[model samples]
Target: MKLPGIKGFDEEALKKYFKNTGMLLIGKVGSLAIKMLSSIAVANYLLSYGNGILTTSVSYVFLFAALAGLGLDQFIVKELHQYPEKREQILGTAFSLKSFAGLICIPLIYVAWLIYPLEGIKYSHIFLLSFMGIFQSFTIIDSYFQSEVKSKYIMQVQIIGNLVSAAIKVGLILMHSSITFFFIAYLFDTILLSAGYIITYNRKGRSIFNWKYDFSLAKKLLTLSWPLIISGIMVSIYMRVDQIMLKQILGDKGIKEAGAYNTVVMFSEALNFVPIAIVSSLFPAILNARRDDKVRYQKRLQNLYDLMVWLSLSFAIFITIASPIIYKLYKPEYISAAPVLSVHVWGSTFVFLGVASGQYLIAENFGHLSFIRTGLGAIINIVLNILLIPTMGMMGTAIATVSAYFASAFFILFIPKLRQQGIMMLKSLFLVTAFQKIFKR
Candidate 1:
């Protein structure tokens, strides 16, 4: 039997499915546009060096935040699907565990600061930024909204919070505030955003906290999350190691250069959020399809690959062409970022493909594949950085990042089937394009 929502098995139903999917894409794009504009403002106000400090600080925060949650986000998303009746218990245990985990992270944050104190800041910024991890732990609630596919709530929360945060940061800069003010604004943003999510949950007639802990469930969560924890660490390393390496090798000045390059590179990341949101919604649907019909499972996976490639290529081309104009509009000093953007935007194609494949693996309860793929990318990134950064500088990092992503993407395609799956994807694309042309004519 076919799954209830799988493909619709007819043109009209399929059209409706695609339309809904497009709506999700449009919502995500709208939110990302707001974020991108705000980011450009921040980049303009903050010089390359200042932007570097901001990016590096956030990277460290993300690393710690991931550690603080101990991979519970992924665990919750995965296991929650299996135990709908235990929703309250599962959410409560995860929340309580994360809160306790956040407390433990306090001392750990201090030690980390002592070990690696960033330049030009007192301990205050460090202290404030430390709360970022704790604040992020509340994101566990996000999975609940996601599972239900009520993405409008998540989008509303993110858009409002981001706008408010951007306004605060921009106002601070206009007032000639110190960099410390920027950091403070960021912390305040997270705190307020977390509160907003909690309030929203409460207003929906759902209690924000059950405050009950189940030791057995917690252990199961931890066991499932272990691989994700490793994957998280690997992802963190790959994402931030370039800046960290630049800082170590070339000092503050080097970081400034790398930061400028990364500003442009990361602009493409806004595009990534759309695909992530789509995949998040589709995951449960795909999982259900896989369980119901084997042939539909293969067809759905193939369709996903086809859709990803089309989207990835279009974005890659647009960004590659627009890089120069985008840099010019941002600021004159940021022109140097164009080449980096060109190289980095192409990386998005690889990233999108890899993520689509990774979702399939996750739906199959093959989370370990995610660990392996990301781990390989991380390893390749580090090795390339060590080898290339001294000689080529920021360009080296850009090259390394692109190379790592491409390797990971190809690995996903290859390890599944050496040649057959590759041919299948190409054939699907060809058929899609030919059909489009025929309809137009």
Candidate 2:
């Protein structure tokens, strides 16, 4: 049952690992491919700055959506893993909480709309896109499936939605559709994901109609998840607030700067799936290890740590080298994005470690520590952005992002409670132990 390359994994576990990661990898690659093509199309059509309008619109929604989710995606998974018999109540409460959060955040989203440089697009376009999160609230279903390692179903849903969205973008290109429509396509994709998740859930012989809300369950979920919500908000800010700051700092020319950085950031983030897909499949296994076998849990976690570091380090080097070529593939005006890409892409290293560590924190009930680490990153990012943007522009924002990610992922590892995870990350970052293991083997 043992695997050849990946150590410490049995046959069935290894099979499920491949099955889950394979589906997720396929979905992520497909989604990223389509999105890049779409971005290229937008760049050609709208130019970099006008494209900024589109990027900024979606960024707003992302920030708001993070707030709207209440950080229960992982909570639902943890709950389901611990209590499968309570699936109906757990999911029902999750969905209602998400819906309520979404509705409550909409008004705040609207009040802040006019602040964005919408180019020629209407505020209403951004407004409509914001509501996509409410529908997305139903994606609690994905968490349920993820806990069960049935991501193939989720993959099917995502792949279908992405294909349809890509087709719409192609049609938009054929018709020389307004840039506004491209942004609309983005919203449509969100809708499709929700629809697909719901359909897949029904086909699996479940109904939301049977999903009954338990107030007590909801309260527990909320209490357990509040730190995650805060952490999510901080992480969201550290990630997206830069784009907004770019607009504010640059004056009339700001949107273009923001847009250019957006593309580079997107390119950098595309490969993030390497870690995410792997972690998603491995998380349930790690959590179960905590219950059944502590030694196996720590060993497996270490192996994962090594793997994440190696993958992220390799990708960071590759992107730094290819930044110019990657940017030139877009448009001439986008060349400035090359430096941004080089600097920004390095964030992926810490991001990978951070993501992997997040699963462990949840499994070990250190969500509050996770939140504190995230808050430190957010504070650092905001302060750095403010100080650097006026002088360094987009590249400044890139620097801030990288530094923030490092603080969150690596810097706080100096703390005692988190020292073990920090050590694992450092090993992955430096490859000290990973190399030793390889040579010894």
Candidate 3:
């Protein structure tokens, strides 16, 4: 049967799309489950202070790793789709660029560490995780698989990696291992995933050795991707800077505060994979609609926004109600995170809308706009953290996160060309779209 509003997609194609998305969703959900259970164990084992140290170190490394990626994955997939024969050049140049950036990042990270140091976090943790960027260069191959619509392979690699990583963490807990061992296990997670990607690619009868880099192609890719690189950095800031700021701003209580905040964040952001899986599976179809039919294109985009709003809103509501009980699973000290989770979970609604609309931005080549919005968000988050943390504590950080995400996602409205989309998203958020459907039916 033809689904209402999705006019252009036939039944068979829809099946294929959902099947692919379902496979990825299952992998992500399964991995999330493993990580959640193991993370809870680790959190309880380490308690607030130890968890705070770990969260701070990971967030710190993550900010620089964003730079090392060069923001080439989306463009690589786009290039591969448009010119399949240039696969080698696209992948090769992307890998080469990322690898160089990865190498440069280590020294740059060292310099950064020297400039702004976090209390309770060791430079050794930063040094070890910096190498994750190098191993992550293999993730360019992940884009290749995505372009080929072979996310199952990527899913396999992720599940295997998470499983192994979780097992290692669990083993360490059993062994009564030191915190340093957990950091090493974290690095091993990236190394193992990169290895899986290489093995999967090779098993498919492709040789990484055949990939060759072109200087001109490098220039072209960089020119096209520079905006994304900056925007990605901005995104990293808003997403991660909270914990860093919490750790730094509070001084004596920083680590424990960060720990509570990080615990709630893991819970709130866990379901983020839902939107990503749906969007990635349906992205090609949306692009095809944009090419073939404008009306259908708008309909599909509206439908996607509507789905995101409902899914995320429901999640937020559920978490809001259940957060207190959820905290019971943790130690008593983490009970403070319960209220924060209730507040932070609402941010996912905007996050879901943002992820869906972000695809539209990429498809329309409004890369700079992404940078502007995300940059705005980073500024907002930083300012709020500085202002609120001293007075309101972790709850202040939660409020700031939600507000920044809302501003970033809806910033499109100020641009006349994209105002229609912003309005469409509003309709979904307000249930105007659902009411319209009900009335029509």
Candidate 4:
């Protein structure tokens, strides 16, 4: 049962397939540019300490959001593809579960606030941000759209929401609003995005709440999602712990410095949309290939890996060279962040590879293994931060991040099957380039 437009089965069709993929990439890049501009405005207006508080609060919210939804986003996406006819049911189950969890999270957040009283206004921001999880759960419907490769609508929604948010933030800053306005802007942006998704789904005559509750579906989703929950939590730890630890180790001043560094750090992260958008577009194709033909499945995976490596490497080099200039352009306060960004941006290359590999694991239903690997990396990150941050400060955090990413990428390549896959990836690199030359001729 071949999918409607898979090209590997027909070598002559490869050019068309690649062309379409390039188009998708262009759209994704456009959307990412808008997002990057929005982020820059927020960063510039907030400065370092203000941005640190905002960053820390958002990180904490993400941690709780990952836990509250229990990884249902991934679970629903994977399961829905298997039963496209039951897209509504799958989304309904995911939506119901996530909504309940979101409700439950409110109380839990209050309790967490009590436990960590120092969070103060940060706690309120995290609680407000939790809606992003509930809003994210609505993405089950978007997954349905993605499974069919209808990405334009979702892309447009994202671009519009971001533009609106950016406009509001800029307006607020020009009016000399408080830092708290930034959080309010974020909340408003998410609400508008969620509404857009919901309205789109409704117009398509689909509802995430259409199916009745099914205990069996709930159990299955939980079984699949629990490991993801652990993995997501650990990923949060690795990604956020540096900031949290910086706060603890460096106090308020350190937090501000870390935040300044992160401003530069996130500019590198802007390149992340390329790999992410590609992976998202490619997953269903990969899954379908896996189901239909193992040889082609492996071949496609190899091609994907090769492309990822090239893209990641190019971006890393460009950012490394451009970091100092970028930091100066942003503000003089961020000049100290140039060295930190150079080291940290290189980590993005490895992190992109790790993300690509993790997608393979997810497509293969090996989420638990993915979790274990990331968990190990997270542990390494925590230990390094503790030992290095006090003595080396922000530079230490940058070093630890790159080190952790390298360790994780290394571990992924060590899996027996992945080792063989890695070799295929290398071979595919030569073949893809050779084929491109032939096509040009």
Candidate 5:
């Protein structure tokens, strides 16, 4: 008789699973290493003020970039999996729509640049960051490789692009390049990544040019993804809006204050790849299981939650304890940020669980609920930042972030639709249930 709840995977399927995940994990490490080194170079060369400018500019661009994406990247990934035979049409249409969205975002960037109150940021920074969003629009190409379970090609191209970008960054620091040069390096990296995608696509005997846009296709994808667009903005708000809030509230020392928070966030941000890479590699399998076996699907998701939570807690604890040493890896001037990093890294626990639960939202087609949860979190973060930043400064900012993350990830238990997922997240958080389930198998 067949056992219930636990679906056994054949050896071949298991091998393929690890192969896809292993390649991406390795690439993430290489990419993370290069970026950390680059961050060190920039932190020292630009100092606090410059680093703040970099962080804020990217954050500003990212929000609008999400709007420009029209949520098509994710829509494409989902559609591709369900209808692999329509790959050409889906990819072609997504590229066309995404490119148009990228173009539209250009003028929007100018509007933001003109209306933005801060005179502290340079125009070149605005211009470079605006275009960075446009280049990022091309990343729908990466989504195509993902649908085919061919992450190895994407990994190779990403590493090559990162290596080139790292070399450029190193040279800029050695030559004492202006901030514009650094911006150029940033833009160039995106260009190379897009080019790399195209190169790999062609090498595999496919042509991006063959892809065409279908209005009906666009409408269908958008129908499913518009919530994501709004949710994306809300997510962006809570994630990056703290820097803006701190910049404004901190008065004359605004830029430096933002830099201080960002310095601490950088280390935490580097490790975010752990959850993203894991989810990306396994999500297709999860999708398949959702159709074939609900019990097994739930079990796999629980396993993911368990891994995400334990790993996040482990990282948070280690980073909190070693914050002083981590700070020393940056310039001595940034040593004050050690406590900030210590306080801030704890947010990673909730962030990881949030990410894991978010997969359930997508797989189960609870996109509206996803938005509600994240939107609520964003509002909470903003209010907390406004109330707390003046008195507590960066410490208050850290607390606000952690609070918002907890609210988003765990507060969903009260919602009727998301109640089960929330309980699963809680199980992952405590580990007792999750561990029992694991060893019982």
Candidate 6:
């Protein structure tokens, strides 16, 4: 099937990428539907208070889990493309680094908890989920498939994983398991996915056992990825800290409030997979354009920005309109999330743009700037959450989130090297680029 033309991009490359991206999107769309239904069911069963506990535990681990990832996936894909013969070494080094970091993250999570514990969340819940960082080491297998442009395999794994995960949640609901079992189910999801990655890799005639760690390569990767590590932490902070803060600031009813907020996020953030699928599937093409043609590279980047803007804007508009009806799927207490969803859904337009620009940053080797932008956003989000939540409640948190997303995604406007790219995004965001493309055709 022919994709509608993007005009300036190489037609052949666009077709190839569209096919690859289409596969990922197909898989993600299926998984998104399954996960959303199961997630709402889980939320309805757990109610606001229990979900508050779940959200806090997951968010807390996610902060430290940033350290566990060490920001190696992008570099891993780049390395594998440039040096396919070194695939084993690259995978091995990354897995070793991530596994070690994941181990350290456990203790770090404990220390952070001790210093400033989540008010009503249990250590057991956090402790169980902390292993997710370690299990995530297996995701290096995912980087391998992405480098090969074999997202179909990754998609298969995601669909199967989500299906099984949804089934487990359904089982828990039927058996009327305690909140603790849900925590186990969460951890099991990571474990199951990791196992899936390994099996898929082996089926593709690749053996995880053949991967070899090299200290020198590990050092090189760390040198390149450290900024991203810090940036990942910062990204996590801005993206997730609000829910954490929500529970803390609201006093006696904080957990219930966080629970209601989680419902809104579940609906809003589910669509994030769209950007990830598009960006990941096209990244190698973007990198090739950078190596081969500067003008084409710029045009492709702009086209990507254009696509991100329109797709996210359309979804946000739909969700904003339908949020009230969407919340009808949830328990009555979650009714407040309907309005918050309307506001919070718009943040995704920036998020989509951010995902696309983030790849541009990696391609341009402007890694340090990534953390700087994210750090600024994190600080803004935290301050806004503090100032707004008390008076504005969940609505304040939504405003803060959308504001932070826009600021971080667009802050490159002030950087000399990044200014042009920022302008391209602005044109896309405002539909100037889209209009120009249409008129030119």
Put the candidates in lDDT order, highest first. Answer: 6, 3, 2, 5, 4, 1
Q: What is the per-residue lDDT of model 5 for residues 1-441, given as tens digits with 9 covering 90 to 100?
A: 322212344456557765787877887788878878887878878988888887777777777866777767767877887898888889887777767777888788788778875557777676776776666656777788777777788889888888889899999998888888887887788888889988899899988778777789878888888888888878888988888888878865767778878877788766887887777767877778888999878878877787788778889999989898887777777887888888889999898888888878888788777778889999999999999999888788888998989998887799787788888788768776655756787
Model 3: which residue pairs collide?
none
Candidate 5 lDDT at 150 equals: 78
TM-score of each: 0.88, 0.94, 0.97, 0.88, 0.94, 0.97
Clashing pairs in 5: none
- Model 1 TM-score (2 dp): 0.88
lDDT score for residue 318 of model 2 = 93
Segments in model 1 whose C-alpha atoms lie over 4 Å from true places: 1-27, 116-123, 412-441
Tens digits of lDDT, candidate 2, 282-345: 8777777878999988877887877777777778899999887887677788898898888898
Q: What would the TM-score be for candidate 6 when compared with the true structure?
A: 0.97
Please name the candidate that would achieve the greatest TM-score relative to the true structure.
6
Better of 3 and 5 by TM-score: 3
What local lDDT score does residue 412 receive in model 6, on the 0 to 100 scale? 99
Candidate 2 deviates by what RMSD?
Answer: 2.4
Give per-residue lDDT, candidate 3, residue 239.
95
* lDDT tens digits, residue span 1-441, model 3: 322334345577578777888778888888898889889999998989999998889999889877899988888988898899999999999999999999999999899999998877889988988898899999998789878877888888888888888899999999999999988988898899899999999999999999999999999999988888998999899999999999898975989989888889999999998988888788888898899999888888998898888889889999999999999989999998899999999999999999999899998989778889999999999999899999988999999999999999999999999999999999989989877776786
The 10-residue segment of model 5 with minimum total lDDT is 1-10
lDDT of 1 by residue, 32-106 (tens): 777677677777788787877776777665666656777777567666777777888888888887777777777
Which segments of model 4 are wrong by more than 4 Å?
1-27, 117-122, 208-211, 422-441
Give the per-residue lDDT of model 4 (tens digit) for 1-441. 322113243453354344445555665677677766767777788887788888777766666776766777756766766787877667777778887887777777678767764332456677677677666656666666666556667766777777777788779878988877788877787678888888887777766457666778989998888888888778777877787777678887876876776676677677776776677667666777888999888767766766676777778889889887786657577688888888888887677677777788877777788778778889999999999999988889888888887777667567786686555544443455435534765
lDDT of 4 at 267: 76
lDDT of 6 by residue, 307-337 (tens): 8888898899999999989989988999988
Deviation in Å, model 1, residue 165 alpha carbon: 1.1
